[model samples]
Target: MTPIGTQELDRELKKGSAELLILSLIEHRARHGYEISKLIEERSGGVLKFNVASFYPLLYRLEERGMIAGRWVEKAGQRRRRYYKLTAAGKEMLKTQRSTWRDFVHAIQVITEAENA
Candidate 1:
């Protein structure tokens, strides 16, 4: 089998888990785009990062799909920001996605264990 490069692996991981990461973060509380990106980066110890160009479009798509809701808010002495929160549908989606991810991880673990045995 062919080997995968680091760049290719990073791209594949982002494509597969970007939505799950976003959804899981917003599940706890509403956060603006920058906050979401920062949290993902920080939480992953700087291994994962999302650029604005890619992030905003994905957020908008989630809003359109009714998975999440975004609202603009103004704070005293601060610029307005749009915050996103998970909706009921988003909660349901998160549950399903979490299960799917667990299953995928388990399968990978099993295969790797067998290979290493």
Candidate 2:
């Protein structure tokens, strides 16, 4: 049984980490929306999932903010899919976000460990 506070914390953590997760996934290459969703689920060991309704808007928002760029691509036999890639700004954002997340986790660890000790 999960406590209410724990559930709330889970939601907040997911909201805060969504951008970093998405940005890191596409740091190396462009990926379509579904592929990104699958990777997140797989990599998280089924602990995290993003549906299209919420996921697409996040992608569009990132694109609009110039953190990412999207273009339609079609393979020889496949339908066109809009793939997203990190922009120069996104690389910088990723770097900053990575540092921020690391600091945040470290702080949480210190506090929790101090409380336990």
Which prediction has the highest TM-score against the true structure?
Answer: 1
In the range 1-115, model 1's lDDT, one tens digit per residue, is 9899999999898978999999999998999999999999999999999888998999999999999999999999989999999999999999999999999999999998996
Per-residue lDDT of model 2, residues 66-112, tens digit only: 99999999899898999999999999999999999999999989998
N/CA/C clash count, model 2: 0
TM-score computed on alpha carbons, candidate 2:
0.91
- lDDT (Cα atoms) of all candidates against the true structure: 0.95, 0.93
- Which residues of candidate 2, in runs, are more than 4 Å off? 1-4, 115-117
Q: What are the clashing pairs of model 2?
A: none
Model 2's C-alpha root-mean-square deviation from the true structure amounts to: 2.7
lDDT of 1 at 81: 95
- List candidate 1 stretches off by more than 4 Å: 1-3
Clashes of each: 0, 0
**Candidate 1: residue 65 Cα off by (Å):** 0.5
lDDT of 1: 0.95
RMSD, candidate 1, Å? 1.4
